[model samples]
Target: MAKKQKEKNNEVILALKAIVEEKGISEELLFDTLEDALVAAYRKNYASSGTENVRVDMNKETGEIKVFSLRQVVSEVNDKDQEISLEEAKAIDEKYELLDMVQKEVTPENFARVAAQSAKQIVTQRIREAERNIVYDEFHEKEFDIVIGHMQRKDKGNLYIDLGKTETILPPSEQIMGEEYEFNEKIVLYVVEVKQNPKGPMILVSRTHPGLVKRLFEKEVPEIYDGIVEINAISREAGSRTKIAVSSNDPEVEPMGACVGPRGIRVQNIVNELGNEKIDIIKWSEDPAELIENALSPAKVINVIIDEDTKSSKVIVDDNQLSLAIGKEGQNVRLAAKLTGWKIDIKNEEQYEKELQDALEKEAKEDPNVEKAIDSDLENLEKLEDEADIEGVIEDVDALKDAKLEEETLKEEEVLESQNIERDIELVPKDDDEYKFKETDETETEIVADEDYEYKVPEEEKED
Candidate 1:
């Protein structure tokens, strides 16, 4: 019987070691849980006789179990289990005095099966609690970061993704619009939050988070990963479009080009990962005007007028480029506004001019120097008009000067011709004697008698 009892103690020690190794639970904690459970079981089965001072102690190294009953030393003992006479207590300890509590060993006949089962339940409960704490600590550090997981299941509109040791929730609100999630499909998600609950760690992840796009770029673009290119800002409309601003520390590196990669493979990969979401990689600039220009991309911008105090900007584009700048239902400009943190008012060149004209007129009306303001505005408008038509005006002036010179030259030539005719008449001999006449065949010729002159007469005249 002694040998059999020794073997049983060894088995208990081996079982504890196995539990510690298997569950990753500390032996000390297991022992404490087991002790508490054994005490409860002992009281339930044997302490029904009002023995309320029972305690159980276990030796961690040797796996020894002992039960003790504590009794207070009293002048007179009323309940034998709860109190002892001073004489009886002193017999056990010479220093015993009245009102002193003393312990007496009360080992049961055997460690009952019911008590062992209760201890098992306690150890199991403790293991589960320990596992929960471990999972919570593990995921708590991962909050606000990207994680890779496989789709585990879906209920209603919520998805459960298996993230190795635990599962996370991707609710409908956090899912990418128009994106389909398939079973066992590997996907990347941004860990939005981590919470502890009665069931386990509740990890909330998202596919539509702007950080998701940021992290995806960081992963795909080597420049971003190596810190050569920094992502300055990101604004995403989920499945529709996203705009990101990036800058490079190295002047030689082009931020937008680097993110775009060769033939746009780098950003294209990210776009594919995000369910074909359109991405615009813009070069960041410190100048608000330049930055706003970059933020509203794929559409040519004519100018950006900024109000530093209001942190707002007016963007001007060509009339034909208006629809592109504003995007479908104003999504482009909206995202650009978000990316730059500036209230943007986008207008075509025509609209801007009209607004500017109206504003100037309104200002002119409000000012005390209304005439002066209106005059200044008119001067500005004229200057602008002149500047626009300078080439045409210069050409017209040159053409008019040429025409006037030609008209004067024609008039002078006519005057000279008339004077020469008068001079010829005057020189044409006041006397006919200065003339010479000749006849040939049936025609008569008269000459002015000058070497430069040849004259012929008509047939009718020749008859005469």
Candidate 2:
């Protein structure tokens, strides 16, 4: 009977090793769980003993179990089972102090039988808990990444994807529109999130995510996978169309060619996977003008006007390609705008020229009197040039007044002189010839006249 009991203990130890290996659970954790379960069983069966502080110890190698009763050391003991006198505690261990717990073996001989009865049930519960944690951790690492899953079933409006160990939810919002999901069909999906629930880990995945296209390219193209080529941006309308911009890190490698592969085989594979969705893979440019031009592909772009402050672009394409550049209901330009992260406005050459002409006419009509005012001003300027010397007209007013005053004074003096001449005249006879003479204190003067002339001198001179 002793040999048989020893073999039974060995079997329990072996079974613990198997659980740890198979369930990805820590061995130490299982030992702790087993000890706790045994302690609970001992308390429930032996409750009449009124032992409140009981602990269970288990040997890791042999799986041997033991129960211990813990009592706190105190100066005075009131409860015999719970409190031990300091003196008694020090007898057991000299290092023990007041309030310290002293442990004593109290394993019931029938405890082994009870533990055997409960071990299987407790361990199985523990295994399920460990598995839930394992799944949560695994899916958490895969969030925002790509994974292959099989269509499982539909629950209400949500679709379930079988991702091997667990199922992920694909809500209607994330499912690609117009695409059929058949049972057991393999599909590629992007992991949007991983959430933990009481049932297990709840993984939320999507087929319409732009990340799915990026991951598909990474999987198909060696250059993208190896980092020679890099995807800059992606915009998708699931089951309809997608636009992806790519660039090359290495100068020697071409990003577009690398993504397209030899003879379009690589891109074709992706197209087929996405239910024949049209994809335009364009090269990325650092210059906004060049990037906008490239983004509006499949249509010949005449020019691109970029407004850096607004982060917007105006793309001009050929007249024939206007509908293509704008796409059906502006879908083409919309996807381009999303991919380039810029607001795009598309126009054809004829429409752009018409807008330019309309703008000029509108400006002219805004202020109708401007041209008339300008022409009138020009005529006035010309009249001024012919009428007066600009420099002379601009002379100081005070200087002109002074000049006029001086001229008037000179004329007044002349008038005064004429009066003096008329008043001071006189007549006299001189020698045999009749001559008129005027005599004064300072000098004498003679006047000769022609036959028709009459001369006169001052009356005072005649008297002299």
Candidate 3:
């Protein structure tokens, strides 16, 4: 009988060890849990003689268990919520107060069997809950990154996704539009966010986000994942059209062709996975004009004018190309505008030309050229006054300048004649046919005026 009891004790130790191993919970943690449970149960009426003070401990090597119940000396027989009177509280610990809960240890041999079982159950529940949280925390670490899961079942119109042992919920709103999920369907999802609630940890998955598209591209295009190429931007209206801009580090490999594959096999596979949603693969450019042109594809663009401050642009197309450039109800340009974050206005070449001509006419109407020309003609009258100040027949600047030249020549001739005999200087008198000198004295005063340049001076017909 002595050996049999020892064998039974060995069995208990082995059992505890197996639980810790299988559950991945440590033996030390199990002891702490047992101690806490015993304390709680003893306080809630688990001890003999109505005193439930307990001390619980586990042997590290043998896994031996012991329990103690605790209570405080009380003077009153009222509600159990009050542990003791002020006098009794002082006996256990001097700092104890009246109506204060105090502790006095009583071994489990001092408690009933039913009370011990209740404490054991409580401890077991707590251990299981801790294990569950450990699992939740492990999976939460993988959130917001790409993940693959099997479709378990739909609950309340939401997908119960199974990531191995744990189940994640894919809410109805997050499911891809028009994409069907069969039972146990293998699928990929991008984790949008993780939220904790009273029920459990909620892993939010997405299939419609632009990030989803980018991630899908990365998965199918191995070059993207390995960092040889990168996706620059994505603009998508899921289940309809998606535009992705891709660039590459390698100069020889065309990023677009690599994505599209030979004979369009690569992109075709991606499109098939997405339920045939059309994709427009475009090369990204730093120039806004080039990007905008690429965004509105399948349509020839005449010109693109941008207002960078507001991030807006005006696209001009040929008259026959307008409808094609804008699509139905401006859908083409609208998609382009969203893709580029620019407001786009599409106009035909004729419309643009008309607008340009109208602007030019309006500018000419307000110009000061015509008014200045009229003022210049009237101002010539005052110029004649300034010229008439000199005692001369020449009132016009050009004519006065010519007269000055002639006078200078004659002065030179008279000086030369004076150096010689005065008889060489002839003062020719007018014989009706002989000319009299009527030289203009507007010589130096005309210096301030702009020189007049005209072919033949027929005053009435000349334009100055």
Candidate 4:
């Protein structure tokens, strides 16, 4: 019997070792839980009032369990389960006093089925609780970070991402709109929160978080990871677009270009991960006006008028660029406001001019002197215009005089050419055979030369 009992203890020790190894639970914790379960089992099976003081001891080395019932020695026992007579207690120990408590071994022949079931339940509950604590500690350290997980399932529009050791919940508010989740699909998520619960660690993750973009950039862009570039701000409309502001601490580095990478390879990888969502990488500036200008990108801005007191800005764009600045449903301006922490009112050049004119007109009506001031300003402007007109007329007259001199010089040269041609004709020999002549009695050469001279002078005068 002794050998068999030893073998049973050895088997129990081996089983405990297996459980500790498989469950990743501390051996000491398991032992304490087992001792408590045994105590409860003993009270339920053996104690009459179910309130008897029972103690359970387990050997950590051997996994051997012992149960003891504690009873007080009295002159006369009133409760048989709780007290022992002095005479009876003296049989076990001679030094027993009237109020001395004695302990008796009460290992049962067999544990009742109900007690066994209760013990199993207690053990299982304790194990589950230990597991929950372990999981909570593991995930609590990972809060506000990025995690990779696989899509496990969806329930009531909430997605469960299986993150290796535990699962994380993606709430509807954190999920990208119109995004389809597939089973077993690998996805990246940003851990927003971690909570400890009875079941396990409750990890709240997000797909639409701004941190997700920052983390993705850090992962894709080496400059961000190395701290050469820092993300200053981010504004996102999930599944549509995201704007990120980054600045470089190193003077030699261009923050926007670093985030964009060579030929946009860095940002493109992040875009693909986000289901082709558009990303705008803007250079961060310390000046609010320059920051707002960069925040509302892909739209050319004419100027930015900032109100320092109100922390607001009026952005002016060309009339045709208004829609681009405002974006579809005002997404561009909305994101710029978020990124810059300023109230941005976007207006076209025409609208701004009209608004300015209206404000001036209203101001003029409010003050009687404003009208007189405006009249004086108009008079000064007209005088300046008149002076400009006189200057322009003087310049035009000088230009015309220069042109007339050039024309006179051209006419004198033409007259000299005509005289030369007449001399050449006179130099031609009359006897030359090239000049065919009929012998007329009247002197026709002088008449012909004189008629030519008269015809040329009238034609030149007509041209002049």
Cα displacement (angstroms), candidate 3, residue 428, comes to: 69
| TM-score of every model versus the real structure | 0.69, 0.71, 0.60, 0.68
Off by over 4 Å in 4: 46-55, 67-117, 154-157, 168-173, 368-464
lDDT of 2: 0.79
Q: What local lDDT does model 1 show for residue 93?
A: 91
TM-score of 3: 0.60
Q: Which ranges of candidate 1 are over 4 A from the true structure?
A: 1-32, 35-62, 66-114, 370-464
Ranking under lDDT, best-scoring first?
Answer: 1, 2, 4, 3
Give the true-structure RMSD of model 1.
14.7
Per-residue lDDT over 191-217 for candidate 1, one digit per residue giving the tens place of the 0 to 100 score: 888889998888889898999999888
For TM-score, the strongest prediction is 2
TM-score winner between candidates 2 and 3: 2
lDDT of 4 at 147: 88
Alpha-carbon deviation at 164 in model 4, angstroms: 3.2
Model 4 scores a C-alpha lDDT of 0.79
Error of 3 at 169 (Å): 3.7
Once fitted onto the true fold, the runs of candidate 2 whose alpha carbons sit more than 4 angstroms away are 1-8, 43-54, 70-84, 94-101, 115-125, 155-157, 361-464
Superposition error at 338 for model 1 (Å):
1.1
| Candidate 2: RMSD to truth | 25.7
